[model samples]
Target: MGIVELKNLTKSYKQNRGIMDVSFSIEEAEIFGFIGPNGAGKSTTIRTLLNFIYPTSGSATIFGKDIIQHSKEIRQNVGYLPSEVHYYDDMKVVDLLKYSARFHGNLNSTRMKDLAARLDLDINRKIEDLSFGNRKKVGIVQALLHEPKLIILDEPTSGLDPLIQNHFFELLAEERDKGATIFFSSHILSEVQKMCDRVAIIKEGKLVAVETIEHLTKNKVKNITITFEQPEQFTFTVDGILKREVNGKEVTLLYSGEIKALLQHLIDLPVQDVLIEEPTLEEIFMHYYE
Candidate 1:
């Protein structure tokens, strides 16, 4: 069985829409990226899995146990970092770490200090005195200190600078290397591209697609740009080609299909320059949504 499984999970609140007929599984020791725009049920799915809110229908299981039935056991092996982190203003960083550590049993003080140093966090400062980015650092430390088997992070890099983001990736890689599974949720495609081996894209509270990064980019979309020796006009008949723009001898084609066939047709033309552009994640989603 997979480490985490959502089987036809459905949820709704009052008149607000939530996830519907969502089903996916995450294997052990894999970094899975969950991508979706706001109100696309990304947070809803995460919350459901964590047992924060019971699903209106269907079910979720982690580690071979029902999420709600075994909530306490599931939490022991799970580390969560939400989109926004809040802490008691009077609590110092060290005190916060110590408090969180109690829940997960015990952590090595030396190891925690090392993690703080690597993340450039100061343990002496009170929570209210820390900047947004620094508070994020504290959240990271708390989530990871006990070394949970599965880490569920929702927009974990929001307040971080570029340098810190890089460091956070390193930390994730290290955790994966240690045989930990990470399910990271974010609307930011670039970060998902960088860290996750596989990704699941959600749109309008539906599971649009799920595949590896390579498969998503290589098989899901295509890019074609052609430059002619002289200005010539031409139109493509491809069904999935989303956009076409012509400028002088330069022609750009944003298409999705077998490139070999597309290239064969293009080669016959009096072409001088050719450029192929890969669709961005946003572009890919936009095409599907429209």
Candidate 2:
């Protein structure tokens, strides 16, 4: 069985909203990405997987055990960072971290200190006094200190500076190298592209496409730009063309069909310059939505 599995998972609330027929699986030691825009049921799916909320229908499993029935056991090997982080106002950062670590049994003072130093977190300061970025650092430390087998992050890079974000990605890479499975959920496509092995895109509470970054960006579509000679208009149509745009003498399009077919169509056009390149993750994702 996969490390994580969901079978026709669905959740509903008033007004006919919430996730519907959501299903995917994460293999052991894989860095799987769950990506979607806000309000697309990303959190709902994560919450259900964690059993923080029950699914209206369908089911999921983590660590090869049922999510709902074995919540306690599943949690023991899981570390999670929610999109928004909150902490006790009165407790110092160190105290809060210690309190969190206590639940998982022995404390790893050395690892805690290392992570704190790497993140430039002031563990001595009160949680209330910390900046949003600092609080996020706390969340990172809390999630990783346990060294859990599965690490789940929901938009975890919020409030972090670019330099720190780079460091955080490095840490995650180190964890992955050590055989930890990661389920990273984010709306930021570039980060997901940079970090995950495979990605599952969700739109409007439904699974859309799941594929590797390379295949999604390279194999699926090619961005074509054509510039024609003055006074010579160029127009051609072929299958698998999307998001076509024209600006005076230049035309841009996303082409996903046969390259030979596109070449055949382009042969008759009044073409002066033509450029073809791979599309970005955002472009690919938008194509899926379209």
Candidate 3:
């Protein structure tokens, strides 16, 4: 069985704005991305898997066990960072971290200290006085300190700066190297493409596509940029040409079809330069989203 599996898993809220009949599976040691725009039910699907909210229909399993039936037992081996961070204002960062460590039954001062220094967080400071970025660092430390088997992050980079974000991604890479399965949910398409092996595209509370990063980016799509010898007003009468644009002596096309046929068409034209490449994740996602 996959490490995490959802069979038509779904949830509905009173406002008619929740996930609908979503289904996907995550393999062990895989970094699976759940991506969409804001208010697209990315967080709702995550909440259901974590059992923070019950599902309206269908079912899901983590570590081969039902999420709701064995939530307490399952959570002990999982680490999570929510999109929003909140804590007791009066508590010191160290104190709060220690409290979370108590559940794991082991506290390594060296590990905690290293994590704080790496993220540029000050444990001596009170939670109330920390900035949003600093508070996010604390949440990161807490989530990773336990060395859980599964890591679930919902927009974990929201409050971090570029430098700190790089450090944080490095830490996640280390965790993956240590055999952790990651479920990363975000509306940021670039970051999801950077860290995930496969992605499931969700839009407006509905799942649209699930594909490997390699497949999504490299296969089934080609962006062609052509510069003709002189200005020409010609039409693209080929199959699978999704979009076409023209300038004085240049033409660009977003295409998906047999390359041989495309090359055959280009051979007879007065082409001076031509470049064809695979499109980026964002470029490809637009086809599905809009």
Q: TM-score of model 2 relative to the true fold?
A: 0.97
Best of the candidates, TM-score: 2
Q: For model 2, how does the per-residue alpha-carbon lDDT over 1-290 read when each residue is reduced to its tens digit?
A: 88999999999998856899998889999999999999899999999999998899999999889999999998989999999999999999999999999999968999999999999998999999999999999999999999999999999998999999999999999999999999989999999999999999999999997898889987979999888886445456788988788888888889899988888877876778889999999999998888
Q: After the best TM-score superposition of candidate 3, give how far the Cα of residue 39 lies from its true spot, in angstroms.
A: 1.0
TM-score per prediction, in order, is: 0.94, 0.97, 0.95
For residue 247, model 1's alpha carbon misses the true position, in angstroms, by 3.5
- Stretches > 4 Å off in candidate 3: none
Q: Tens digit of lDDT per residue, candidate 1, span 1-290?
A: 98999999999877787999899999999999999878889999999999999899999899989999999999999989988899999999999999999998897798789889989999999999999999999999998998999999999999999998999899999999999999999988888988888898888888988889887777768767788999988765656667777888887777876777777778788988777877777677666667
Show the colliding residue pairs in model 3.
none
Where does candidate 2 stray beyond 4 Å?
A: 231-234
Question: In candidate 3, residue 14 scores what lDDT?
Answer: 95
Candidate 3 root-mean-square deviation in Å: 1.4
